[model samples]
Target chain A: MPREVRERQMLDAAVATFARHGYRAASMDGIAELAGVSKPLVYLYLNSKEDLFTACIRREAAALVRAVRHGVDPATPPDRQLWEGLGAFFTHTAEHPDGWAVLHNQARTSGEPFAREVATMRADLVAFVTELIAAAAREAHDDPELGDREVAGLAHALVGAAESLAGWADTDGSVTAKEAASTLMNFAWAGLGNLMEGERWTPR
Target chain B: MPREVRERQMLDAAVATFARHGYRAASMDGIAELAGVSKPLVYLYLNSKEDLFTACIRREAAALVRAVRHGVDPATPPDRQLWEGLGAFFTHTAEHPDGWAVLHNQARTSGEPFAREVATMRADLVAFVTELIAAAAREAHDDPELGDREVAGLAHALVGAAESLAGWADTDGSVTAKEAASTLMNFAWAGLGNLMEGERWTPR
Candidate 1:
């Protein structure tokens, strides 16, 4: 097989191994065996355990970003766009559970290098959501302007909630991707809409 | 020192060690040294590493639950109760950053035993939030009632959002516990109140 094909196979095996055994316990030998390649070849291709883990993080993060970006249509309204993006996110995570595990569970907990990689992906997604929220606010005529910090906070909350819901959906096989997305939309978008309208919930 | 005092000291040291180095890399020897006790004494008091870790988890979880429970007053309205509870949570986490890290980052990422301990605490908090949401819904008299699963979803979202904000607040010192709780209340409670009033945000 070609080098590219071989590299992909190694990464697939690496993600599976890392997701199952975690970052510390996962071995190059185990990854190589799972990849059906020699240990030397695994080392030759990926270089080291850290490098292999980083490679897996980058690949999974990119795939996730691509899925969300593809699912969203620029022409659609802000709510529709968010809905579509969330649906794609749930579908992609469900289909690639191991990849999701690597990005969400393993990478963040491993160490600085891996955690930073996942954090970068998260920052990008948070920025995207922030833009959508600002756009939604703009669409609502005469709505009060949201400060940058508030927007960032809302984006972080929404992303965190989506991630939590994704884990819940993954654990319970009966819950569909669409259902998860809808639940988040109702839980979040309605709130965002209310915030945009200056309908604040004050302490009694 | 008495046995109870020594045990408390050991758990505090264990939490710091586990939070900084993670579970697999963290050693009982390091924990003993940090606690200013001998290895044999540490082992004698806490038994094995597993039990020691479990003890740390239970202590931290209980402390957290106690803080929230103490902060909320039953006589106050649901919104005030949630606000007070969140304030207590943020204060407790900020004060015990290491313990918070152990529960939020380390414990969950560790194996089944530790994760389940943290999960039990999480379930309790989620249940508490669910009851608050149900109360808020009831307050908005004659409005549409949210299904049980919907309330559960909302509770999870709120808890996840709170966790995310806690981490953010810990990283940035300028953000106080009160500020974090208020931001979450504004971001979440508003939407929840709207939902209870049958004000849903739909895709256009």
Candidate 2:
């Protein structure tokens, strides 16, 4: 097999192992056997367990980012774009449960460089959502009610909501990706739509 | 001082240390000095580092849950209740940044018992939000449009959004707790209000 194919197998095994057994408990021998590769080859190719885990984080994060980016088309209306983006996110997370677990569950808590890697991805996602919301606001009205800070806050909230929903769907098993996407879309877009129209919810 | 007072001091110090230096890096010596107690006294009171961290998690988690519960009035309208609940949540998180960090960041990734401790708090929060949303749905319509599963999903999304917004406010520093609460209230209430009125965002 090509080195690339072998490396992919190793990463797949590593993500599943890390997600199922956690970072501290996941063993190299198990990962090697799961990959169907020799222990020495696993070490030689991935360097170490830490490096292999880092590789898994980078690949999964990139894949998720790319999935959302590709799912959204700039030419589409903002709400549609968000719908597509969220659909893509939920679908990817649902399909790649192990990868999602690695990124959201394992890497984040495993410490140091791993957490930082996920943070960078999170920052990128927040920035992407921020731009999306800002554009939607500008398009909706001449004078947008959402200030930059508020827009930033909204983006964080939306991303967090999606993440939480994804985790929920993962655990519930019965919820499909489409259902997760719709749930968040209704929760977020209607809220954003109301905000755009200046129908703010104030304390009574 | 009495044991209860001394224990509170130790937990306060532990939470701050764990938040700042992280669980593993946080030292018994540092926590003891910060708590104004001897190292042996710290051990005697808290038992061990693991126990001290667990104590911090339990204390902070309970305090957070209590604050949110106390913030809402059952007699008030559902929307008002949500607003007050969110307001209370943001205020608590903002005021207790160290405790928030300990629960949100430190306890979650520290592994095993610590992670489970935070999960229990999270489940309780989710259940509380679920009940609130379900009550609102029932109040809004005789035949609620939101199914049980959908309501459950919305609860997860809302909790996730609050968590995200709290973290954002903590980092931005300029964003006050009131601002965070208001931002989410608008984002969530407006969306949820529309959903109650059957104004969902369908794909175009």
Candidate 3:
């Protein structure tokens, strides 16, 4: 087989292996065996375990950012943009469960280097959400009434909400991406605008 | 020290060590050393690493649940209840950073018996949020609008938001518990009733 094809195959195997066994637990030998390659060749393509794991993080992080960035329409209103953004996230996570695991579960758990690597991805998502909230306020109040600290907090909450729902949908494979996204939208966007009037829900 | 105080000290040491090094990586010897006790004595109190970790989870989980439950008043509106619950969560997480790490970071990553153990605490929190969201809906619509599945999803969002923000606050030590709670409230509770209006924040 070609080296490029073999490299892709190795990455596929590495993502799966890393997802299941985390960084420290997963050895290059195991990954190479899974990839149908010799350990030496695996080393040839990916240097050390640290580099290989870094490669895995980079690959998964890039894919996620690309998917979410490309999925949503920039021209749409903030709400629709968020809806599309979440849909993209759910779809990507479902399609690439191993990649999501590598980024979310494994990367941070592995330690500082990898955590910082994934933190960049997380910060990207947070920045996206922050900008969205600021823009919404601009369109809503026609001025940035929300303070810097408040906006930062809002961005964190939004990202957290998305992350929470992602894990939820990940475990419950029966739930569709669109369905999960819409459910989150209702949960988050439904009760918003306390300044307008309290649209609170109550139990029967 | 008294037996209870000594046991608490050992448990605290174990949790801090485990949170730092992870369940698999953490050692009883290190825990004992940190507790300023001999290894044999550490075992005398907590028994084994597994037992020690479980004890940590139980302690942290109970404390977290109690804090959140204590913060919310059943008689108050669901919105206020959620806000107060968030405040308690932020405060507990901030005060007991090591305990929070054990429950939030280490417990989830450790897998198996530990994960299942923390899952119980998590489920309780989710249930509370689920009922609160349902109650909020019923109070608003005067009927049951949000279904069981939907409520579950919303609860997950709320919990995830809280968990995410908790980690955020822990890492960004400059941000206080009160600020974190307010951030979550704004991000989650704001403009929720605008389901018809369809408002959302997205990257501009």
Per-candidate DockQ vs. reference: 0.60, 0.92, 0.48
Whole-model lDDT values for every prediction: 0.87, 0.95, 0.81
- Which numbered prediction scores highest in DockQ against the true structure? 2
* Candidate 2 regions with alpha-carbon error over 4 angstroms: none
Top TM-score prediction, candidate number = 2
TM-score of each: 0.90, 0.98, 0.88
lDDT of 1 by residue, B2-30 (tens): 99998888888999999999898998889
Winner on DockQ (1 vs 2) = 2
Model with the higher TM-score, candidate 1 or 3: 1
Expressed as tens digits, the lDDT of each residue in A1-204 for candidate 1 is: 999999999999999999998899898889999999999999999999999999999999999999999999988988899999999999999999999999988888776778899989998888898898888887775654677677777888888888888887777787788888887888787778778887767775
What is the CAPRI rating of model 1's predicted complex? medium
**Ten contiguous residues minimizing lDDT sum, candidate 3 chain B:** B195-204
